[model samples]
Target chain A: MTVSLDLSDVTAHYGNTKVLEDLSLHVAEGELVSLLGASGCGKTTTLRLVAGFLEPTSGRIKLGETDLTRLPAHSRDIGLVFQTYALFPHLSVRDNVAFGLKQRGEGRAARQRKADEMIERVGLAGFADRFQANLSGGQRQRVALARALVIEPRLLMFDEPLSNLDAKLRVDMRVEIRRLQQINGTTALYVTHDQEEAFSISDRVAIMNAGRIMQLDTPEVLYSRPANLFVADFVGFENVIPMRAVAEAGDAVRAEIEGGGMIDLPKQHYTVPAQEFVLASRPEGLLVDTADRTDGLPAKLGLRTYLGRAYQYQCDTTAGPVKANGPLGTPREEGEIVTLIPQPEQCCLLPREAK
Target chain B: MQRRAHPALIAFAVLTFLFLIGPLVIIVGAALSDTSYLTFPPQGLTLHWFQNVFEISAFKRTMITSFQLAVGGTALSMAIGIPAAYAMARYRIELPRFLGNVFVLPILVPEIVLGFSLMKSVAVGSGVPIMGALLLGHALLVLPYCVRVVGASLNSFDFSIEEAAVSLGCPRWKAFFTVVLPNVKPGIIAGFILAFITSLNDVSISIFLTGPGVSTLPIQLLAHMEQFFDPTIASVSVLLMFVTVAVMAIVERTLGLTFLTK
Candidate 1:
């Protein structure tokens, strides 16, 4: 049940304008990889390329030993769950699930057995005779997933699978999809713009921008150690401070921060460059007005509001307005001078790339 | 709500309806006339002209020819138009914008011009006979309307459904037949009926391409009207009206007229 996909230097274009460019990533056996990006970032195009719906402008797509670049979509043996959950409006739930099996020329009983098995797997056993128009949105999505996965394809792809659902249903369905993928041990690729959805379900998440993969890593690493500014910004790093590299006498390099503030770069923690770089920090990594915290930088708090178990403060710092989330009971007022300290280990240094 | 009618508006509406229905009512009335001449008011009400129309072999032959041509023309148009519409809908092929214009340009050309063009192209260049020439002409004339209707339908269709099917291991052709074609059937059906009726009632192109012993019903009716001023042609006209109305009613029943307007 192991499946590995290799997309090497893939580029896709719509006429003269390129949609995906030199995109490359790999999903190990039975791993769920998510391509997370904003709209028009070529995430769907990459999924389509892997599914063989679109021919790459120039590249190779290898699934284990088979090169699927030239293969048609059906021959690629990849399952795709569409964003709209495109179930056949005319077919019964059972017939929709049986479509692929019948296409393979399976006998009547065999097809019905497989369809019934898949229907139960998706928790729609009793609704097999129901038409798609009679089902709810969640049930329709589950049926679409069953139709895609019933064939046991080499690769499974979901195109914004949970985007159409409400917030609560999205959370529940994403967990269910992840559980099903893991239980079946299927190699899956999930495309979505929701950062929380990508982080929650993916073993590895690839952040894309302008037809290129900016970074690919586990969710924890992507959040704490994004490779560039795009991935940092996309992964919810609210503050990206501008820094110029300076010489360190011994253990640390002195980096000149923007707005006349300076911070010593711990050589072990950061990737120091020769000239200039940017330091990225997530909102949760910044600590404000704590007695035991070291490296406290002076900042003016603008607004303070309680967010569940945390206090969200908008502070005007050397790096513009920084949004920092602190512990719920922390005392802070608007227009009050406070010292905000960022965790040294959690701060990510990225080489500057043009917007 | 009170149902009060404005006298002027009511009069205008009645006049418009009469203006539209006057010719058909007069023709139907003449079809039942006992007189040999076609007159607005019948001297005697009878079914004699209908019997005359039925007894004539020319009328029967022409009706059969028209039915065959219309059916063949519709099938041929569907064979070419459906796939062309699908391709235009899915793929960003080269010159599709231009191809669309080329497909619809035939409709803009007058039927007389199309008739002459078909005659010079097929009748002279390839040396096809009268049947071949008539079919070729009708297919060409009706193809653009089919493409326009079917293409409009395909435009509104969801492309993702076909992709979903293909990814489920159904081949592209199977996916098209199962997912795409079934969804677009309403439009295809409307286009089929429209093309059929257009071919059936066509006189300009049919008259030019059809040789001796191969006249269509409209051409036969025109020939009868010119040679003899009789109510028999009016009876034939009423029969043709029935055929057109029946075909239109079937189309409206099957696909709904809303498909046409959309």
Candidate 2:
């Protein structure tokens, strides 16, 4: 059965070193949410807390109507697939999948039948009698997936499940996991550090930094409109220029950059009121023109690279080295001066904070 | 690049193997001698001494006693050592290095000193029964082997498997029995055999603890040799050697002999 998981004001620490600070997140029923961040950003810690492996120093965790904050991992009715695909080496693939059913007191005949069905579903039907050590990495991953899903847990969690696979198999398993989760409509929480993996599999991505959630939004929204400097920088915003707000108009504020350039930002994007703000834009959001235009900032092109489908150029502007991607045409030579224009709606405004 | 060993090195290796196994060959040969006196390169082959081992009541009683002590000591050591090993491997035990040293201290002490100490403390001071004192000493002497073997297996084990079990609706204790125990079974079996043989072959400790009527097979054999230098003792020694080899073969067939080396 599908269930919503909610964690409010959760704080955790490992002996006196604080790992998570007042982290709160909610996953809707049958929704897949990914906690995405770099190493030591508390993404794995958050997943462990939700899985009942680590108790929060202060917070309440609930799955639907059940209070799971004080429950032990066995009573939480949750399933976790480990990064190493921790299948029991002594047990066969079928036995590994039936482990949970056996624990639930299922009859031997019934458990075997169910395990066979799950093994077939995961494409390991012929390999059921094989031990984990005999299977390849991709096959081991499927066994882990089957083991976790056979129990029909209330909430399913994965800790970098695809990280151990080869590059091609990683993509295949990612799509397979996403398809299974959708078909089952199971509430799932996935943790990963790769941005592309998180974006492709997750319905919503929660960007975490320094043990706190920086932004929680859909993949498209998070890419287009990050909340602050950290989220923008983490989500591939290569150009961040400090600006001072000079004028406020209807639903828009005009800010002046350090190098005598001005841009208008929507007022609703600002989370805090400040005279100093930061303007952030993705590398693809800036348009490059060869002709010297009146409405564009002048910059000198430094390095140009051909990225198969597009030409990416590094431009030295007043805001520092800005990266932009354009159509594949004539290669731009080094030291060529070009006019770069930031797309109006693609820019985000944030209150400047100490880095 | 690989090169063949020198002829001198091969000769040295052959000599070393003979040096190690030559005494056992002499003892087996003497056990088959037809004459009453023990002699290697026997004049004639006979199984009379082997049958004589069964006729002696003291031999039969001491053999049973040794078997009981080995079984009891091995079981006790495993019951205590496996959990201790698991705890030390999984959790952060306080002063782990110091505690590990404490568990292995018995092995480092000289067997004669350990025997004397147990004689004074357990036999004289505590006034435990002779059999009890011998069992306790054997268990203590073999505990280090159990801990070391089982601990090595646990060190390489991935603990996340147990956590995976607990997350799948199995309680922690059940998870341990069903998951952890099965995976480390080879280590347990190896440790048991090592401990059992150690108990069976012990002489110094059993000498200090044996009362008037209770004696281990090794101690009884020592006492018998002081009175009679016959081929019967060699026959008993050959039988004990056979039992040890049989146990090792069973271990090899079931769990592979690599566990012992590990």
Strongest candidate by lDDT: 2
Residue A293 displacement (Å), model 2: 3.6
Assess each prediction's global lDDT (C-alpha) against the native: 0.85, 0.88
Fnat measured on candidate 1: 0.76
Clash pairs of candidate 1?
none
For candidate 1, the lDDT comes to 0.85
Assess the local accuracy of residue A130 in candidate 1 as a C-alpha lDDT between 0 and 100: 98
lDDT tens readout by residue for model 1, A1-355 = 6789999999999879999988888999999999998899999999988988789999999998999999888888787788899898879999999888887789989999999999999899799999988998899999998898888888889999998889999998999899888877899999999999999999999988899988899999987787777777887777877778767736667766778666666676666744678777777777777433324455788788887868888888776888776776656778877766767766777787776
Off by more than 4 A, model 1:
A244-256, A262-276, A290-294, A303-311, A325-334, A344-346, A351-355, B1-5, B92-94, B124-126
**TM-score for each candidate, following the candidate numbering:** 0.92, 0.93
Native RMSD of candidate 1 (Å): 2.8
Per-residue lDDT of A77 in model 2: 85
lDDT of 2 by residue, B1-262 (tens): 9999999999999999999999999999999999989897986999999999989999999999999999998899889999989988888444356776777888999888999999999999999989899989899889998998888888888998999999988899998899999989888889999888889999988888898899999999999999999999999999999999999999899988888887
Model 2: residue A300 alpha-carbon error in angstroms:
2.5
DockQ of each: 0.64, 0.80
Evaluated at residue A142, the lDDT of candidate 2 is 93
